[model samples]
Target: MIAEYADRVWRGESDDSIVDQGMEGKGVKPIVDGVGWWSGFGNVVAFEGSGELALFDTSSPFSAAQLHADVRAWSSAPLTAAFYSHGHIDHVFGTGPFEESRRATIYAHEAVAARFERYVLTSGYNAVINQRQFQAPGLRWPVEYRHPDVTYRDSLTVRQAGVTFDLFHAKGETDDATVAYVPEHRLLLPGDLFIWVTPNCGNPQKVQRYPREWVHALHRMAALDAEIMLPSHGAPIFGRDRIRQALLETAEWLESLVTQTLDLLNAGARLDEIVHTVTPPEHLADRPYLRARYDEPEFVVRNLWRLYGGWYDGNPANLKPAPDAVLATAVADLAGGAARLADAALDALSRGDERLAGHLAEMAALAAPTDAGVHRVRAQVFSTRAANEQSLMAKGVFTWVSSESSAHANRLGAPE
Candidate 1:
């Protein structure tokens, strides 16, 4: 059943919802002779070794118990060690459950420890941003983390039960990412490196993503020529040719963005101009792995600009701009009133100019902070914008903004 589902997903016949079904503890199914894969929001791949089991990832806190139970069901052998793909909350939380029987030595990139430290330092901020990002108001950031016991800088090779596991470090979605290769099995565990979506190099609410470094990592993985690939978030890929095409094409997609962005930046173009101009390679648009369902290419362009050029955005007036409210009030007065601005916003929305509508609606609300009528229009503008977007990142942010205005509209009784 999983194989058929995986094939459908690979062919782009299945939607993202199928991949995001939220971990029913699908149980550990055999990948090869001795390896077992437990599919979840965060997949855990267990390797049966000399009277013990080694895991690729431990999964999130929510799925910890189920992950343990499912893996235990597959194998009674105790977990001897585990490899963390990265320090993301989802991939590092399940070890505690397994540690009850016997503590498993964890191995990861050295930067994973620093990532945990930063998570602790910004726990509250992380919680709030994540709540907005995922639309989970009740979401709480985990203060506690399972730090890796063994850390490596570049690469580490571990031989357990006659199986060789080679770990390599790279920066992509996170600063601390580990890509593992098992030679005997001819398997590649890419972690989130190849999540079957457009590389998430442009998360608006999160930290910096290394597109250039990520491209390098993808290229490196492609060169490995692994026959079977198991990603942290998506279905496994079979055959060397299929795996090679996915990895290399993904690398090309990111490299296209990086090259285009750098060309514009080197040409002394403003970020606004560069963002509007730099485009993903047209040839690769139809590739199933290159779709921008989770993170769009435009966001990646913005992230590249921020990486090379500072936050100035090449707009002189924006460098020391007036407060948003102050600017909005001036514009509102020029347009006659805040109601006029709100009307213009609605007109923009009706014309299918959501980008313009968003700007006008925001200015209208800022100009008349207490006007429920303006807030009503603002709500409609953002909700419509949210509906039009494809990527979850844009949808989440737009939906959150709409909800904010919606609360005001409800509280003030909507101008009636």
Candidate 2:
């Protein structure tokens, strides 16, 4: 059944259910002779040999016990070692459950420890962003993390029960991403590097993502000619041809964005101009693995700008911009009143220009902070904007903005 689902997804016949499946805890299913895949918020891949097991990614804390139980159902072998796909809480936290039975060595990139430290330092901030990003209110970020027992800089090779596991580090969704290859089994484990959606290299709320480096990583993975590919977030892909196509196309998609952005930057284009000008490869738009369901291409362009260039977006006024309220009030005064601005926002909405409507609605609300009517319009505009968005990141942010206005309308009570 899982194989059928994966095949459908690979052919673009399936919908977003593939991602939904990844988030639900499921029993371990064999991919090949000795490899088992357990799907959850993060998928866990286990290789059993000689009464011993080696795993790629332990899965999230929420699914830790379930993963351990599921893997145990498949094999009674003691865990020899586990390789972390990255320092993400979901992939590293599940080891604790398996460790209850036997201590297993943990191996990850050298940057994993640094990522853990950063997570600890920004736990509260992480919690708030995640709450907004996932629309999960009151979501708590984990402060403590399981530091890797063994760390390597570029690559490391480990053998467990007659199987050789090769681990390589690359910067993609995170700085500490690990791609594991079992040469004997001809299998590849790409952590969040290939989460079945468009590469999440442009998360608006998170830190900078390495798109250029991510392209390089994907290209390298494509050359491996793996017969089976198990990603940390989604269904496994079988067949060497399918694996290669997915990796290369994904790499090309990211590379296109990076190249376009850099070209504009070199042409002395401003950030706003570059963002509006650069476009993804139209030919690859229909590719199953290249959809922008989680992270859109535009966000990747912005991230690229931040990477190669600095934060200055070439607008001098914005460099030392006035407070939002102050600027809004001045504009409102010039336009006669905040009510006029709100009416203009409605007109923009009527013209099917939500982008313009959003700006005017926000300015009107800021100019008339006490006006519930203005906030009501703000709420409606942002709600429509959220509804039209394709990516989860944009939808979550727009929804949150709409909710903020809705709250103001509720608290202040709309005008008669």
Q: How much lDDT does candidate 2 score?
A: 0.88
TM-score of each: 0.97, 0.96
| Model 2 residue 370 CA deviation in Å | 2.7
lDDT of 2 by residue, 1-416 (tens): 76787788778776532245642555888777888888777788888998888888898877788888888899988888999988888789887877787789889999999999999999999999988988989789998787888999999999985689888999999998899899998989989989888999889999989999999999999999999898988778989999999899898889999999999999888999988887888999888677788999889999999999989998899899999999999999999999899999999999999999999999999999899999999999999999999888999998998999999998998864
TM-score for candidate 1? 0.97
Judge candidate 1 at residue 12 and give its lDDT: 78
Q: Report residue 53 deviation for candidate 1 (angstroms).
A: 1.1
Q: Candidates' lDDT values, in order?
A: 0.88, 0.88
